[model samples]
Target: MERLTGRLVQMYGNIVSFLRKCIFYILSVGLIPNHIAFIMDGNRRYTKRLNLMQGAGHKVGYSALMSMLKYCYELGVRYVTIYAFSIDNFKRSPEEVQSLMDLMLDKIEELLREESIVNRYGIRVYFSGNLKLLNEPVRLAAERVMLATAKNSKAVLSICVAYTSTNEIVHAVRESCEEKWDEITLLNSSGGYVPDESDHLIKVTDIEKHMYMAFAPDPDIIIRTSGETRLSNFLLWQSANCYLYSPSVLWPEIGFRQFLWAILNFQRIRFYFDRKRKQL
Candidate 1:
């Protein structure tokens, strides 16, 4: 009887899984986000709520992120970017900050060694941030994962660690300026350069090419978990016209239903967004 009961449970689980796959396939037939950016928030709050250890919340958040990536890839979304660690996160208590860094290092190393989501989906991994801010061990682990997944092109996963949009913009500006210095000097050498302005003024395209997220097109949808409606400096410039969705659930608690709701909402307004895209 026990064996029969086990078999029944397995059968029920399989049926549920099959039903979920069907629903996902049906949803994929509609307009889907080609690229999605996730701002994983409320980790500390989640931990506090559960009264867990200092870093357990982040571990749970990592699991949630991996599940979302699988669902996105299965739904044919080709690009995924996650705001893993923000630059302002350094302001947290030293022990908390160090715990997060250690957690990141472990996750990156696991992605390299384990047959995890990246490997299963042929996703190329990228770490986009000021790596210098990370300790040497963590930096090296990040680099190793990047190199390990460099050639896999089935999909792209960008993890923003120690990053903020403000810093990204500044980096782009500095890089763009440095690259154009020679051209500027040549123009000034003509000796009649206008002091007010010139036709060679810095163009928007110049800065865009130097942006960290330039490797992928602008995200079609940006999802921030947690009730906070603000962007928290995740992807400012790249998100000028992107659809923003904020769900009140914490990062670790976000599930398929929430993701499905986000995609369906995106579909409902996709026509309006398309019109806006053309206008822009």
Candidate 2:
């Protein structure tokens, strides 16, 4: 009976996979997003609603994220980003913050495994944020995964931890300025001050190149779960013209239905944008 049940489950999964592919084929008729970003919200609320142990919602939410990533890759999205941890999240109670950190560490290791979704999809993993703010163990683990996946160029997955848009912009600007200052110092050492406009000015492109998110294009769609419409300091600079999707489902309960709806809406908007461009 156990073997029969296992076969039944396998068959059910196979059917679902086939159906999903068929839907994806239909979706290909329209232009789809090359990049998508997710703000995983409402994990604590999901845990409370499900009467689970404290912090268990994050585990479930991780599962949902994997499923979403799989869907995105299968649908040909080349870039994906997740707001994993915010700098302000440290303001939570000590126990809760530690619990989240522990969870992040474990997940980072799992992502490095050979059979993980990242390897299966040939996705390069990038941690985009003030990684120095992470505990040593978590920071090192993130670095290791990045090194391990550096060869994967087919797809990209960016995890934003200890991050905020304002912070990212400031960090990028500082790095760009430092690079320019080094050049200026070298040039000035050989001769007097060169009062050139180009040397004195920092261009927008310079700062953008130093941005942690420079590896991927601006997200075409940003999905925030729990029906939250605000960005909350996530990708504010990169999302100048991106579409935002707010589903009513909590993070742990999120599924492909929400993902599909988001894509459909994004494609609809893209259609209008394309038409407007043609008129010009």
Look at candidate 1 and tell me the lDDT of residue 42: 85
What TM-score fits each model? 0.92, 0.94
Query: Poorest 10 consecutive residues of model 1 by lDDT?
Result: 192-201
Q: Best-fitting candidate, measured by TM-score?
A: 2
Error of 1 at 23 (Å): 1.3
Q: Write candidate 1's Cα lDDT for 1-280 as tens digits.
A: 9999999999998897788789888987798799999999888899999999989989999999988998899888999999998999999999989888888888888898667888999999989888889999999998999899999999999999889999999999999988887767877897745546456666899999988888988888999989777889988998877889899999999999989888999998889888988997
TM-score of 1: 0.92
How well does model 1 score by local distance difference test?
A: 0.89
lDDT of 2 by residue, 1-280 (tens): 9999999999999999999999999999989799999999999999999899998999999999999999999999999999999999999999999999999999999998989998999999999999999999999999999999999998999999999999999999999989988877887898866756565458889999989899889888999999999999999988877789999999988999999999999988986655654674
lDDT on C-alpha atoms for all candidate structures: 0.89, 0.93
The Cα RMSD in angstroms, rounded to one decimal, for candidate 1 relative to the true structure is: 2.3
Off by over 4 Å in 1: 1-13, 186-196
